[model samples]
Target chain A: MTPERGATAVAPVPSETVTRRESTSRRVTGPRPGTGWRQRLEIVVFVTPALALMATFVLWPVISAARMSFYSWRGFGPMDKFVGWRNYELVLGDDVFTGAVMHNFIIVFASLAVQLPLGLGIALLLNRKIRFRGLLRTIVFVPYVVAEVIAGVVWFQLLQPEYGVIDGLIKAVGLTPPEQGFLGTPDLTLATLFVVLTWKYLGMAVLLFMAGLQSVPDDLYEAAQIDGASWWQVQRRIAIPMLGPTIRTWMFLSMIGSLQLFDMVWVLTHGGPANATTTMATYLINQGTGRGNYGIAGAASVILFVIAFVMALVYQVFVLRRDTKEAR
Target chain B: MSRQKMRTFGGGGPLVYALAAVVVALTLGPVLYGALGGFRSNEQLARDPAGLPDPWVTSNYTNVLSNEAFWRYALNSSVIAVVTTVIAVLAGVMAAYPLARYQFKLREPLFMVFVLGLLFPAAVAIIPLFILVTRNLELGNSWWGVALPQAAFALPITVVILRPFLMALPKELEEAAMIDGASRVGVFWRIALPLSTPGLITVGVLAFVGSWNAYLLPLLLLREDMRTLPLGVADYSTEHSADTAGVLAFTSLAMIPALILFLALQKRIVNGLQGAVKG
Candidate 1:
């Protein structure tokens, strides 16, 4: 799916001539007068299965979640009790839900704050002709490819209070380790989760930045060099500016991924250490599945959806419009 | 772009290498430690938490490999991933074909529906999806219970990636086939499907990897023997909380399939991401 180079080059031909030729061919092959009906049938046959699956699985659940938020249901039985907006009120007023919302926003901002510069720095360094570039890139991306649960499990072991490798290393250097371990300490849990997230996702940013760099024509760099510009100046003025669209796109994705953060946090701490790392997703799961508070979970899910949808919409309008508009 | 020219134009120096080395070490350190820690006995780990195994015991690996539960998880994961991939690719390609090639008025709106699906995370729908699957569909504890939704989620990315590929196929080929009396279906089956193999492979690999690594859906849907590897790993880690080495072994073994698949198709996966981003 690399960008198609010349696909649009065929669009400028006169449309009337093309339609006339196609019509003449169709008239010549006049035996098949049922072609229109046949084509419509083909469209139906080809598209129906997917449309059905999506409607049933994706669209239905979304609508159901909205419907579910209005009623008080444990998980089973009939939907008799209509609680109206009580669930939303409860979810919003609850300190834990508010805390989860805070954590989600923290991750969303923290990811962009930490990963953007680090990934860009690495991508810049690696874009140079370097030995073992391919191998280095692969190693960086391996964690991303690994299952989130597995990564969480590995980190969970590494952060064990006394016996974990991290504490052991700290002690080896003559510094005292945390009594409750990094992940165990309520104050440190969110920070530790952020660190793990950076480890897992920075590679993607670097990869994307590198791809964006590849698309910046070599001549720009050459021209900058001819003008006696410094390396940093070239990157700042030419390379990075050219990467605007890529950076915005990456940030949008990162924000969405962060808001939905669940897998790693669930496996590692279960949003534990006194729920310090509870995201919207974890809070919903903790309510819906863990305690059978399906109504609260539904409300939380709807809130999460709305937050993500608004952010995506705003980003598309305010931030991403330029990139997409340029493409069009 | 040539290496020699790059060097002449001031390529990366020792400082760059040093920084890159540090980043790589930090990235791979925990993963390597986990894999190697499995070879150490509990006592050895207790004694030297960061040290290598004194005598690389094989029992941890052997025990996990021998355990019937581990294999069951693997089998369940394989089946679910395969089913999810097949359905997602087949349905995704079929839908993407007409959306890409046809001039129907509803095509744009339909494609937009899938595009909007991109922003809809499974977490948002997990609650009602649970109710729908278990209570309404009665697919609880079955492979389809998880695979169906997973495929549904997979559809957006699949269509997004595959549509451009279908659209990029030279129009003359289809026109030629039509002139030769081949029906639209004949043209699609004979021409469109064959030429879009790369796109198919890209989407297929992505779907399979996604299904294999999926956790939340399988966690809720599947119970007992139906649990996939991620759930199994969580359960085993909890059950064997004291057996750190065994947990490590199980975790490492669980990751191998995904890692191996990734290594094999590393290029396509990277390209696919680029494609998605660009699109």
Candidate 2:
């Protein structure tokens, strides 16, 4: 082919070569023989199964939830009974729903205030040329991978009112354990769950910050140090700004994740001690499937979905835009 | 500060060591305590909750392991996770290939839909999904009831990770195969699929772990006999609330399989996470 191309070279060969390159680029961008029905057919064949499954399972459910929110159904029956806005009205008016929304806010605020900074600090510590760095990283991140049910069970044992590990240690120090235990006390349940949440998810934020830190040029730190900036100042002035994208990404993820939290809370407290730890997700499940009130559950689902969708969209537009643009 | 910043040694200090030690202890303490506590009898646990077992017992483990319910739960979890991973990966690979290689008008928009799927947590959509699966589709209480929706949820991450990976492969290889008169499907199967193994493993491990540990979907979709490991543990706890030791033993047993998988594929999981987040 090379010899034939050379032998057939003509006066306008440069233009021909340029056109061929464009065609080649198009082929690289997509399947060859562009604008042909056959190529389109191949694309359809490749994509149909995935698109079908996603639409049927993911997309359809969300749409159906929207439709189901206006009707009263027992989750097992037809959606024949229509109650326009009553389900939403009830969900909004329900004290438990209010409490669950408050709990979700508390989690989001606490994650932002506590877990994010704590993770960054640890990432900075681990990013240092420290011994056992790999070991430390592995140990911390192990919990993120461990099943939430197990984390809940593990913490359940620790926070038991009487002879659990935490109480045992406290009693050994001559202090009394709280009367209702950590998980059972309304005063302490949300706080205790927050602590557990921090423990479970902190590793993810730390690892993310660590990845961000790797991209930071070491010479910048050196430059800051030579300018008489302290170690803390170097991090605050340079490293942090450099990690802005990562921090934002983690914050978005953390907020959305906190909103949708289920398994850990379900396993730990079942949104109990007077619904103290109920987040949007646990509330939806407990009310919907647990009580078989599909209509109200669907209403709650729409509310939850709107919250998640709006938060994500807002973050992607207002926060993530800069990071993505810079990448491009 | 009278210190030299040693990049190689991480600028070690006594304070750093102290902080690191505290973090490690805090992080691993509960897990280790729980795992070790499983070896103690209920009596011993009550007597000295803070201490090592005075008389270690293997019977707790033996009893849980030998129980038919335990195996049943474990097997159910395996089936759900494995099935979800396989289907999710297959669907993701097919979808990602075109999204990665093609420059069609709808390409970016289609990819965006999958990306947006990451935001739709199962909690927010469980009601209708439950209705659709159990009532409309009549898959209620079946393994597929859980597995199908999970695969759908798993698709977004799988596609996101695998698309970039497929894009990174050399385009010339496919062209070479095509010049030999190979069809598009032939090139995809022969060249693209084989080259995507690492990406496959990354997506596979992720989907498998996510499915294995998933709580809400299985909780809603599957019944008692179809209960996965996490469900089984939850059920066991409620039923055996009296036996703290037995609950711990059950928890320990449930933790082992996922732990083994995570430990074995720690590198891939961590790196894959970094890749997915960065992407």
Candidate 3:
């Protein structure tokens, strides 16, 4: 048994222990009992459910879908002869796919512009002591925890042109309400979804930022305060720079989440109003499941994986290492 | 100038209070509207859309309770959620504690695989997941179709989290138990498990929230007969689109269980999310 290496080692500390263990697993310590042949097999028993599910549902499906790129199967039927890269060609050939990718860029932009800033800003504000701090923090987080179906219900209520409580409230204070719900229009739909998503995810973001924030010591804040640094100045100079690692993490997560956008959009818009808000996820699902063009859907899935994998690689390779150096 | 600045200050007093009031109002406004929306009659919904009920009808609740489909969906969701949480927590805790305690081979790769599971949005994996459930596994159109996949997906992160909490376990306590001739199982079951109940509860509650409000997985894997609360509500709302009031009522019904879960899990889940972020 490896003696307990302490709790912090179990954390994501980039430990050598992790590497050493993985390297040794493939090599043999000779088949024996408890910690040997029997143990390894039992470990597989412990791991099999998760492994099988991950493989069957996650890995196997992905591999099958990747192969579908060679066929022109419309999802419901037999693969009508391999077209060999034709699906990739078709996807590349199509303007809709290009637009979808471009729109995904919009989602990235929206996250950077709205959710990141808003979440960080709120987190910074709430991190300080003030009366009712608990209440305020909880209120902000409510959006994230609220069910998407309920958020869909709330947004539907708020945006209803005639009966929309929001519209009525706006008119009560006097502004010409739009003819329809913002989601009912094409130009506004994606932006509107962006806002709702930001709202829903802001709580999660703030929670993360708070975690990063707590690690920055009170002594630093006190010293800065004594030096006559304004609140904003301290925040910019101390907090932001101190939070570099966390910001990267939050941004990385937001990107992954943005790419994976589904449930709420599916509930609220169903990628409608002429597909103005079409995300890669929505488009993939639409083709694969909705239209039953399984091959194309499979292709979309592979592309999604490539995109997420590439981003995670960059984060793991460059940014995470730099953050480590900064801390050291 | 000093006097003017002072008026705006007091660690952000009245002004901050005013702003917070706006924040609270904006946050609560829609929920207030939806809750009240279901109360008003259809004519009241259309004519005096923002007004309170004339008869102050509680019949929406009664209507919701009387519907067999509604009760069935609610029951299905609760049963699935409770079962999935218990199983996931037990399995996740066992798996995580060993990984945290052991210096076994392939540990990092296994850990990475679990983290990879977290980072992969189920949407991408969902397509192949559907085919596997329907044809390969032949488990389609059942609660197991949804519950099992949810437990699997949730396990990776949930386990990673509990590992940290378990590693935080005091070595002396376990050593003492071992000195008493306690087997590994005895130590874990009696000591470590009891100590980490907080972590277990956090993971369990989160799993509950995720499964209870789940839509897409159930929608894909299950047929009409197997609809859960979320799927049922979404479908019912769509079918009764012409009945906007009815749609709101249905949405309200769907929202209750989630609302209750959130209220219950808010403190633990928030703290857990913080703990798990770095991991």
Candidate 4:
């Protein structure tokens, strides 16, 4: 309901509020007059369970992580060793964590750089009246629906140095496979990871873009056609421009997802060979769970939280504001 | 318009079909390879790395299907997913109902709390969550440890989607129910719940799929025999590294439940995502 409705529902006659309150308080020893108590009970009953769960699992952990960041605890007993900002200093100084941050930024930019054009191109093609459109859409989107770990495991098997299908195909094409394989080679690991990431995520981009395309009114296309514009011209001059909000929104999602990339990397390389593919997530996991460096992990997590928060705030303020304002 | 213009604007031609075919092939190639690779023996794979099974063998699939461990993982995954979905949908519906229909002072701010939750990724809070679940709550190695947290994480999207659905319902029905002496709770149960089945189903399916495929939470909370399908798939691959065909069989089977769910309710899933993004 709207604010005005809520306001009136709470106090029907504002001028009588004091008298009503006095009368209700005076009659508290007897029966209540109206549905106010019943409504409040209903609201409390309905809202408390979710709020409890959220506070326990979601809100509490975030606060705990922030608190844990300043302590040198091994994730057990008492977290009494208050090391101040030493953990943050160590995490920032560690080359692995710094590299992880760089890798995260690389994926964030690479996803937008690569997926944008590729996804848009595919979306445009699929947007046309084509045969097997539903089937094609389903096929493209299957990878996105599949579990990331499973996809990583499948690709890991398929990327196994000599025995992997990809390597075998490369060999069959009269090209030499990498000596240590795509993922095994440190220099190629991040790039190779990006390829798999693209394969796994492009479906989502295309699906979202196609959904956005549906919102572009057909009248514009018809008008363009009436003006004797070519198909490419109509798309460039009309469809793409109309997709600005969708594109910006998708980019925002992509950036957030890329920053937190972990599942696939964890499965495929474990940020492997030479720590080439460590994401902010994998870095924290490695430090805390893998190495018992809970303090460092806590610091890294906070840094990640800040980075994601800042980037999201900046994007919303700069880019997404237009879309929301337009929606309003 | 000429035939060329019609071809350009109306139906995509042979070239478009060809491009679509290539895209489809690229998209499904790895998935098919993994699924079909299970039909070949390790020796057969060694002989022809990319070849189809000349004589399709059923042992790999049969072996994985018959394995007790595989079924154990599947059962664990199903139980966790069901628990997560039930909790998430129930809590989401309960919370969304008041936010959507009731007039309250804290409604907007409370809704914004859930909205803020959207930007809070699970990874950021995961380490502390693991500590909280294992040490503090002592829910380690238990289904609720994972299910409860998964459901908690699923709440934001669930509420975001379901709130709109509830809001769009005709307010007159609620008013009529109230006039007929039905309590708000009664109207919610009798009218709102039944009418919002589509939204409920959408959020339910999302929560289930999400819990089923979840890795980090289960990976941290569960161990050994308690592992879910994704973890099972990863561990099975590593343990059976020499058995390529068997590993493929295991991995392929691991994905089937989610794939079937997606294929069956694809339109709903797509629409749910669209609604979430639009909202």
Candidate 5:
């Protein structure tokens, strides 16, 4: 086929000759075939399994919960007549939701605070040629693929109130071990969770950033070195600038991940000590799935979804677009 | 002066080395705590959680293996994960083919549709997934419930990873097969599938690891007969006595497949990740 095309090209191949190419271009930049009923049928076949599955499984629940939000009903009883924001009224008025929202930010803020520098430190360390680098890389990537629930379970023991390994370590190191269990105290629970979350996730972040670092052109660093820039200066001006996009991606995942955090908290604290560690995900789950307030849960979800959706939109439109546009 | 000096690699600077050491230790500490410390006796565990088992009893290994539940969890996890991996790869590869090859209308839009799966948290889809599993499909409390949805969810990344490799293949070969009067199915099966080995392996490795380690979907869907490895970890830790050993044993066993998967795909992951960045 290539040879025929090659020969035809030498012989001034007719423009209308390439049937498949013409078809493809017309299909993409359309108005030629007008509307491709055949193509649409094929698409249905290709995408229907996924789309049907998602729509039935995903959108149905979404719509169900949204409808429920307007009513005052637990999952079991007859749907109460629409109260039109009464559920919102309760969510807004509830100290638990407000407190959980604060706790969510605490987790996000604390995680980013710890993960950023720590991730960079690990990445920079690994980037340097070192002994057992392969083994180290394998080890670092371990936690990332492990089930988040197992991570919670493992860390809980380490942080248990009595005879827990982490508590033991704290006393061993002469740190004032709290009288109440680490997770039992509302004040300490969020902080302890923040630390644990950071430890578990920072490995993946470091791996990503290290991959970003490897992409920074060697010549830029060579030029920086020739300019007699110190190590700190080289990192600041060249490495960080080149790594800007990756850092932004990391920040986005961290935000969304933190927003959706339930596996760890559910397994570890279950929003204990007056719901101090409760997050939006946990709160929604408790209401919707646990309490069977399907409607309120749906509304709460729509609220949470809206909040997450807005944040996602803002990040994509504002941070990502602006950065890429400026970079260009 | 430094460019002229080329005397030693600055990459070997002491601070850089030290930083890597500390980070590596911090990252691997928990994994080591489970793997190596599993051999130590209960007395030794309390005495020094930090120490490696010396004069290693290896009894923890024996004790864990003796638990009938341990084997059950292992077999169930493997079957579910293996089945899930097969389905995910099949669907992921099939879906990715049209996006990769056909340049059809809505191609980019369709590809983006797949990518959206990455963003929606399990909560967003859990209710629906559960509804489908339990009420609609009558798959409630079955391993199939955990396996199928997890496969569907994993398809996006698997497809993306495969598509790039497919795009860069020699279209001449595919065309050559077609010209020999081979049908589209024939072309895809005979020509395309065999050539995409590395990409297939990479996606397969990822899918296996993903299904094996999954927790939330299983928690919401599966019950008694469908106890997965992560479920076992949760049950063992929260409900059982002397959780340290059981939890450690379970965690270590779960981690083996992941680590082995990583090792098998290490080169591809490194390459694939870098390719993604450049693109």
Candidate 6:
């Protein structure tokens, strides 16, 4: 959970550090102009409402979930039994949980490989003076504006066996459709889910890349062309390198998004067909509500929170540090 | 190299047009088909699954529109989304002002807390939230049960957007007003709020659409009578399992409000999101 404040904070690292030392030295040199208690109270008044809600809803729940994970409880019972690590143990040993984790990674892999490339290609194509640029951009972004559950329902219809549009098109081209249907088959469910994910998500990626492309100086391309650079070379050495920050941002978003995949899976397959499409989110919801085992669900929630927290922290430190330094 | 070589892939050619067409088809084709499918009969859909309906029936739309359940769900969604947007925006404005204008010690850390809120996706916290709202708070089935958490979750992005806008306001205006003996609160209300209208609208639209499109929170919190549009969409799927046309119709109905909002603020949303990523 990297804060936006961190963006400004990280950017002015040297200056801020210098100012901090200068302020301390100034305090040593002379009496500082002290802020009144009234001013401090006013700051509190301004920030308290949001801070209160965030504490109750986000921060408190995170802490409570960690605690709840340690005790055995059901949906409507007291948390009397001290289960210790039993719930975590059960979750760790469960095949469904493991499968869900693997499925999340599959989505991450697919998103990195398929979604980003497809988005970049479409963005590049649209970046040119193609026909109906506005219309095409709007059309591509339409799916993203639509809700995830609705996307799930729409794709569910399209991927229906023999009767769906995909199968109909397959038949029209004289090919055999999958016999067990898309969502109904274990081997094909995750892959089909990937297709739907790509369709629903690629637009955002395209938009991000388009924004990045807009910032790349036209003179760079012109200069490269004058150097007798081929179109591919210009893209490889100029466009792609220039797009590093945006690409990194999109990749981070896509990874976290894949980790938290729930609505589509819940609506379309409910992690069925041998749990092929199960994600950690679906697993948590299943334990929490579908089964009413709050303790197990709490354990799952903590695990997910830890994974996401660690991933974000590591990504910020190792990956984004270079970008921030380069920007400075 | 010639100036012609500077243009990638010759800029405008048959091949580029062909590729653009393919991209368009792949992106918009399914949504268009789904929307049109609602107008066709179930039999029509089953028979000719990929084209315009010969006998485009209004019954599906009529059926969903006339159904009391659909309206109830839509009404619930509106109430929740509206309440959440209002609370989130108000709180965001209040909180962002201090973060932007003050150089207090807690300013960065407090702002960071709100930013960290963005990283906690609602999915992971549902369990504890369920317990806290239902058992501890006794807010089960109420609109606030869903709305409060939504408002809370939205604060990070709302504050993120608003703080920068607040920071950009000229301090001389506030100083000029203070010279006239106006209080800080009065200056904030009369000056800063009016100046940040664009940022407010941007955050409001984002929060509203997000609340309306939300599925899991309402799914967990509400009962049958209190079902939101998304839950209603799921209900339509289950209750009318055999009626694909009706399901699609219900889906289209649930979508229209959010879509209309997005279309109205399309430019703001697009630019705001683009700026968010770049920032």
lDDT of 5 at A5: 29
CAPRI class of candidate 4? acceptable
Residue A293, candidate 1: how far off, in angstroms? 1.6
Q: What is the C-alpha lDDT of each candidate?
A: 0.86, 0.83, 0.72, 0.86, 0.70, 0.82
List pairs with backbone clashes in candidate 3: A75-A294
TM-score per prediction, in order, is 0.93, 0.91, 0.88, 0.91, 0.86, 0.91
Sliding window of 10 residues with minimal summed lDDT for model 5 chain A? A6-15
Error of 5 at A65 (Å): 3.1
lDDT of 6 by residue, B1-279 (tens): 244245554376788888888888888888778789999999998898897977788899999999999999999999999999999999999999988776667877888787678789787888888878988899989999999999999999999878766765666687689779887788889998998887789899989988998988888899989999888888778788789898888888788888888778877766666555545
- Highest-DockQ candidate: 1
Candidate 5 lDDT, tens digit per residue, A61-151?
Answer: 6666677779877655467678898888888677887777777777777777888887877776666556666677767877787778777
DockQ of every candidate? 0.59, 0.55, 0.34, 0.47, 0.34, 0.51
TM-score of chain B of each: 0.95, 0.94, 0.90, 0.94, 0.90, 0.92
* Winner on lDDT (5 vs 6): 6
Taking the tens digit of each residue's C-alpha lDDT, what string does model 2 give over B79-167?
99999999999999999998877767888898988989898887877888887888779998888889889999999989988986786
DockQ of structure 1: 0.59
Tens digit of per-residue lDDT, candidate 4, span A1-328: 1322322232223224433443443343222348678878988999898999999999999888889899998877788999999999999999988999999999999999999999999999998888788899999999988899999998998898998899999998999999999999999999999999999999999988887776565656666677687778777877777677778889988998998899999999999888999889999998899888888888998999999989999999999886665443
Question: Compared with the true structure, what per-residue lDDT tens digits does model 1 show for residues B95-191?
Answer: 9998877766788898988889889989999988888899889999999999999999999989988986776566778788988888888988999
Which of the two, 1 or 3, has more lDDT?
1
Q: Which residue ranges in model 6 land beyond 4 Å of their true spot? A: A1-35, A225-231, A324-328, B1-10
Candidate 2 vs candidate 3: the TM-score winner is: 2
Model 5: docking quality category: acceptable
Q: Each model's RMSD to truth, in Å?
A: 4.6, 8.1, 6.5, 7.8, 7.7, 5.4
- Against the true structure, what is model 6's DockQ? 0.51
Whole-model lDDT, model 3: 0.72
- As a whole number from 0 to 100, the lDDT of residue B269 in candidate 3 is 73
Off by over 4 Å in 5: A1-44, A71-83, A322-328, B1-8, B47-55, B175-185
